[model samples]
Target: MHELSITQSILDYSLSEAKKHGGVKIREIRLLLGPFSGIVPECIQMYMDLLAEGTIAQGVKIKATTLPLKVRCRDCGKESEITRRHIACPFCESLRLEILSSNDFIIDSLEVDTDGD
Candidate 1:
């Protein structure tokens, strides 16, 4: 699954950052997942657990926040939140729409235990 690759990348980045900060173990990782990101949180968590096996990140907790889909109507200049099933503009019923958000996948923060306790 693609979640495996995503989890691997997250682990690699987290490990690198933790090393830079002299971290001994990773505790938590917070993520912001957009509605259009197409990544499943459950799969990511499962893959993270498997990938972290026997590593310093073992038992690390992964927390994700889902962002709603927001779109701006080009014709009426109105912004609205729409589900995946509906992407058209509600105000003017126009097909010309600009996606404002809900397409980003970002790692917001990480919590780690440093070596120097």
Candidate 2:
């Protein structure tokens, strides 16, 4: 699955950063995933668990927060949260909308054990 590639990227980046920090072991990796990002958290976590074997990130916890889908109506300049069921603007009922969020896949923070304590 694509999640394996994505998880591999995450592992690579985390390990690189940990190496910069004197080879610290990763404790947790926090991610912010938007609803429309198309990356399933469960799948990514499973892939990470498999890929992290024998690495410094092994047994690292993967935490994710799903961001809401926020859109702005281009016609009326109104902002609203929309789900997959409804994409039309609530105020002006306009289909012309600009997505403010919902396509984000970000690694927010990494918790590392630098001192080995």
Candidate 3:
């Protein structure tokens, strides 16, 4: 599925970064996911576990945090967090809104073993 590709990308990026930093292994991976991104953390984890076999990222701890959808009202210019179902501006009830953060898929941080121990 799509999770497989995404997980592959993550693993590749992580491995590249670890190598750049002279890391012997990856210890942890922290992810920031958006509510509207439609990326399932569990699926990502499962795919990572499968794809990381015999790699530096094998057995790495994966932590994912889902962020709320934030939007800015065009009418009142107020930023507010809204549920995925309701995208309208909460303050002015305006349908005109600019999405601030909703479809984000970011790698927040990575813990790598650079000591080669």
The deviation in Å at residue 68 for candidate 2 is 1.5
* Model 3 Cα lDDT, one tens digit per residue, 17-103: 999999998999999988888889889999998999999999988899988788899899999988777778888899998888756
Cα lDDT, all candidates: 0.87, 0.87, 0.89
Q: How high a TM-score does candidate 3 get?
A: 0.88
Among the numbered candidates, top TM-score falls to 3
TM-score result, candidate 1: 0.83
Pairs with backbone N, CA or C atoms under 3 Å apart (clashes), candidate 3 = none
lDDT assessment of candidate 2: 0.87
Choose 2 or 3, whichever is better by TM-score: 3
How would the candidate models be sorted by TM-score, starting from the highest? 3, 2, 1
Candidate 1: what lDDT?
Answer: 0.87
lDDT of 1 at 93: 81
**Reference-based lDDT, residue 19, model 1:** 89
- Estimated TM-score per prediction? 0.83, 0.84, 0.88
Superposed model 3: Cα runs more than 4 Å off: none
Residue-level lDDT tens digits of model 2 in 1-117: 778888999999999988888766898999988777788888988988999989999999999998778999999999998876776898988999999875558888899888654
State which candidate has the highest lDDT.
3
Worst 10 residues of 1 by lDDT: 97-106
